[model samples]
Target chain A: MSTFRRRRKTPCGLLSGLLGVIAMATVAAQEGPGLGETPSPEMLAAWDIDIGPDGSGLPAGSGTAAVGETLYMTNCFACHGPEGEGLLNDRLAGGHGSLASEAPRKTVGSYWPYATTVFDYVRRAMPYLMPQSLTNDEVYALTAYLLYINGIVARDEVMDAETLPDVEMPNRDSFVIAYPRR
Target chain B: MSTPEFPEEEHEQVAGNGLLHRRLFLSQGAALLSAGSLGLMTARPAAAQALDPWLLTPGLALSGYGERSPFEADVARTVLPVAGTTGSGASRTPLESLEGIITPNGLFFERHHAGIPEIDPERHQLLIHGLVERPLVFSMEALSRYPMESRIQFLECSGNSRPNLASTPPQESCGFLHGTVSCSEWTGIPLSILLDEAGVSSEASWLLAEGADAAAMTRSVPLAKAMDDALIALYQNGERIRPSNGYPMRLFLPGYEGNACIKWLRRIKLTSGPQMTREETSKYTDLQRDGRSLQFTFDMDVKSVITSPSFGLALNGPGLYQISGIAWTGAGRIRRVEVSADGGQTWAEAALSDPVLPKALTRFRMAWRYDGGAATIVSRATDEAGNVQPLRSDFMAANGPQVSYHNNSTQAWAIDSDGAVSNVYV
Candidate 1:
C-alpha cells in the first residue's frame, strides 16, 4: 500500500513482490486499507515505529566494528564496561548459558530475539543520558560492538541497514510470540 | 577489625561499609528490648522529626499562593520524566515523606505513560456515550453542579516495583517503594451517581476510559467497580488537582491500580468487554509460563515497607534511633507490621501512626537502638484480609520473573559498622 512503490508488472519485480506484498501506503480518502483510516500523516510519521521480523527500523546507516570500538569507548564503554560486561549498570554480554537459571542474564546477542529491535531501540534511545543523540551510523557501530562482544558476530564486521537486518540473534528462536493470539 | 568478613553462615549477613542486616531495623526481639532499656527516651512529638526540614502542619496560614512550593523550580514546565525509570532525567514528588492522611495536590505522584497534555479548559469536554439511555457530553460547569463528596484514598501503579525487587533489592530510600503510591482527599461526584445521571443501561458490562494524551490511552473497567466506588475526581488533597496528577479531571477508581484510574480523562464509552488496549494486553499483563498471561489483575493487595531508617540513611551512631515505615493495603486497613532485626529470626509488632484509615497509607514506628555491631533489618506487613507481605525468596520462588509487576514482597536492607546501608538478596 506504499504510494512510493507499486506493482508495475516488471517481470523481475513480480518475482520479488510475489515473496511478500509490502503494501505500505501513505495515503487516505480513497477509503484506505487495514479496516480503518490511517492516522494523520504527522501522527503516522511520529509513530511509524516498526521493526520488521528481519529488523525494519534499521535506519540508513553503516559502520565498521573497528570504528564502533572507538565510538563505544567514547560514548558507552564506561557504564556498559570496556567489553559490555557492565560496570555500574549491568552485564550486557555473557549469558551463553543463563536463560534457564533462576536469573536470566540477558544481553544483546544472547537474549534479544531480533537484530532489528536492537538497531531500532539503540537509535531511538541509548547511552541513557544522550539518548537519540547518536547518528544512525553510530547506533549501527555500537550494536555491532555489543554483538561482537557477545560472540554473535566477528569483531571486524561492517554493518549497514540491509545487512544489519539479516544478522541473526542467538535467542531469536527461543522467543515464542505470547500475544496477539489473546 | 577482622576485615569485616561476614561469610553469610546462613544468617543472611552482609558486611561492607554501611551494611546493616536487612533485618536489623526491621527486627524487634533484642533490638526493641534493648531500645526500650537504653534508647534515647526523648519526649519529642512525631511532628518534631529532624529529617524533614519543611514539615509544616496542614492548613497552615498562607499567602495568596495556593500550591505548595516543594517542587516549584520545575513548576512552569510541569513536565514528567521522558519515560520510565527516572532520577536526574525526571524526578517525582515524594508522597511518603509527607505526614498526612491526604497528600497535597502538587505532591501527588505523577504516572504519565505519555507526557502531561496541554488541555484547554474551554475546549475540554467529558463525553458519556454508548450503551446508555441518553448519551451526553458534560462541560466542566455541568460536572460541578452534581452532588460532590470527598473521601481519602490512595492509588498505586501496578508496575511501580517491577524493577525494585531484583536479586538485590534497591536501597533506594522509602520514596521509591512507598512513593509510587499516594493518598488524597478527593472531591467529586461518585461514578455511580454519574451513571445514574447518564442512565446507563443495565446490560453495559464495561466502561472504556480514555485519556486525551497523545497516546490516546484507553482501558476498560467493570461496571460493578464503576457503579460501586469509583469517583470522577476534580479535587485532590483538599485542592484543585495538579496538572501532573490529572488536573481538570480524572477517574478515581478506589482500591485499583493507578493506571486504571485514568488521568486527563476524556471519554467514557460503555462496552461489553475489555477493549484489550495496548497497556492491558501487551504491557501490563503478567506473562506466566505455559503461554498463559495474567490480565485484569486489578487489586494492589496488601504491602508495606519502613521508610525511615530505610536504605541510603547513615546513622552517626547506633544509640536509640527510632525506626519508622509506611504500610497500606488496597484490601483494608493494615492490621500490623512485623519488624525483624535478626533477618526474620525474631519479630516485634510496630505501633501504627494515628488515623490509620483503610485504603490509606499507615505510618508505623518502633524505637530501636544499635549496640556497636552491624545487623540486617526486614519489615513484613499483614493486612486485614490475612494477606501478609511475602519474603523475597518466597515471592520469586512462586511468582517467577516472567511475572512482571506487583512484586510487593518484603524489602530487606543491611546496615554495616561504618553506618552504611545497602539492599540485599535476603
Candidate 2:
C-alpha cells in the first residue's frame, strides 16, 4: 500500500487525479434539451472501431510472426523498407536508448508505450496509399510481425486481441501525463 | 455620257466643294467640343474613375461567383516537409502578406494527418456515443438548428516555433518561422450545449474526437474544457467554413492548440479517461532533457512578433517607421505588448488595436525613429493572467533544448547599418 501511494504521487497519477476532480465537479444533475436521435446499433458497431489500451474493441483475429512476415514483405515493405528500418517513411524498428541521446529516433520499439496502439494505428491507417483496406487477420499478422521486428516478442508467438495487450512494451513506463502549470 | 467636256471648270468646282466640306467639318467639331464641356459640367471624371469598374464596363456582368481581383496574388500556404507521405504534412499561413487580424479563408494554415477529405455534409454525421445517455447522431442540418455563437479567436499549432529551438538562429522570414498561427471569427454552437442535449453521463472525464479523414485522426480532450469554451464550429469569418479549414463542422477549442480542434469532425466518444491517442502521445508530446515527455500541453503561451521590418524586408534609410505586429494569449486577453528597440535593455508599451478581444490576435504598433545604426527590435506580450512572454534564454532554461512544442519565446529582428533586417537572438 505504501508503494502504491508512492506511485500515485507521479506526474501520471497527478494528472489522473486532476481529471478525477474535473469529473467530480461536473457530475451535478443537469437536464438536456434531448436533441438528436439515437443511432442504430449496426451504425454504432461499424464506427465503434477504436481499440483502447485495455484491448477493448479489438476484432476476432489471430496471427503468428511467421504469417505476419509474409504479409509485411508482400504489402508493407515498399515504404517501410525491408526490415521496417524505414526508407522514405518512418523508421519502425531499432531505436532503443536513442530517446535519451541527442538524436531521438522514436520508433515503435523505442518510444511507443502500448502494444494495443500499434495494432490500432496499423488497423486504422497503414500501407501509405491504401488505408483501412487490410483484413482483420492481416492486421493481427502485421501487428505480430512488427512486434517481432521490434524484438518485443518471439518469432513463434501468436498475437490475438487477448494476447496483444498483455505483451509489455519496452517504453511502457516512459510515458507520463504532465500539464504545464501557469 | 459625253464625259463632261470642260476639265478646268470641273477642277474649280471640286475646290469649291472641298472648301464647303471643310466648313461643315469645322462646324461639327465645334458642336462636339461644346457638348464635351457640357458633359464635364454634369459629371466629374475623377469620381467616376474611382467608382466600380463594373459600372464603366457594363458588358462584363456578374458571373456565378465573385473572385478576388487579379491584381491580388493568391497566397498559398507554405507546406512543411515532415511527413513520409504527401498528404500528411502541415502548411503555414502567409503572415507577411496578410493585413489585419482575421486570416483569409484560403490563406489560413492547414495541418492534416491524412490530406483534406472531400466530405458531403448531408452524409456526414457527428456520433456522440460512449458515456452519453442518448448516444445521439447529429446531421449537419440538426447541428445548425442549435443555438449559435460567434467569437474571434486565434488558433496556433503547438510546433509553430519548433525551428527556433535549433542551436543556431533561423534566418527565415517572420512569417515562415511563425506562420502556423492564425486568427478568425469562428461561428458555432457551444459544445457544452451539445453535451447537454446528448445528456452526458457523470462518469465521463474525457472526450475522444475523431475525424472522418482517411487517417481517422483522433485526440482526447478533457471534458472540463469541452464544457467550458469549446465549440462545434460551422462557419469562419461570417461565412461557411472552407474545406481546408474543416468544411461542414469542426471542434473549435478557442485557446487550445490547433490540433486539439479536429477538422472534418465525425465522432466524439465520451470516456472515463484519456485514450492516449497517437497525436497526444507520439506526435505533439514534448520531450524533456531527462527523456520524459510532457503530454496535454494544450494552451499556447503569450507570444508577440514584429511582422514588419522582419526578415526579407528592407528599410529605406529608416526615418520614422510604424513597427506593427500581432500579440495573443491562450489564457486570456493580452494586457499589453512592450517593444524593445535596443534588444531588451529598455522597453516601451505599444499601442494595442481597439476591440481588444480575449484569446484573439491583438494588433500592436509602435513608432520607431531609426538613425540607421545597427539596432534590434523585439516585442514581448503579457496576458491578463499576468503571464509574461519569456526570452529565448529564459525559455530554454525552463524547458531545455529537447523541448520543441509550445515555444512562445520573444523573437528579435536585427536591422543592419545597410537597412537590411534579419532574425537574431538577443
Best by TM-score: 2
- Pull out the clashing pairs in model 2: none
Off by over 4 Å in 2: A1-33, A180-182, B1-64, B81-84
How high is each candidate's interface RMSD, in Å? 13.0, 5.8
Docking class of 2: acceptable
Candidate 1 lDDT by residue in tens digits, B315-341: 555554556677888887889987877
TM-score, predicted candidate 1 vs. hidden true structure? 0.61
lDDT at residue B143 of model 2 (Cα atoms): 76
Q: Tell me the docking grade of candidate 1.
A: incorrect
Give the per-residue lDDT digits (tens) of candidate 1, residues A1-182.
24322323445867756633543233211111111112244543444333344554456768767778999889877777897887855577887666555455656655665566566556544666565578878888888887788888887898887887788777655543322222
Residue B331's lDDT within candidate 1 is 86
How do the candidates score on chain B by TM-score? Answer: 0.80, 0.85
Off by over 4 Å in 1: A1-182, B1-62, B66-96
Residue B61 shift from truth in candidate 1, angstroms: 12
Error of 2 at B285 (Å): 0.6
Model 2 lDDT per residue over B1-426, tens place: 011122232221111101111121123432322332221122334545466776677555689966766757655678776446676788888776675688888778888877888999999999999998889998887776665678999999998978788888889877789999999999988888778777789999999998888888889999999998898999999989988788888999988999989999999999988887778877888777778877888888999998876887776663435567899999899999888878888777776867689999988765454666888888899999999999988898887556779999989988898878888886
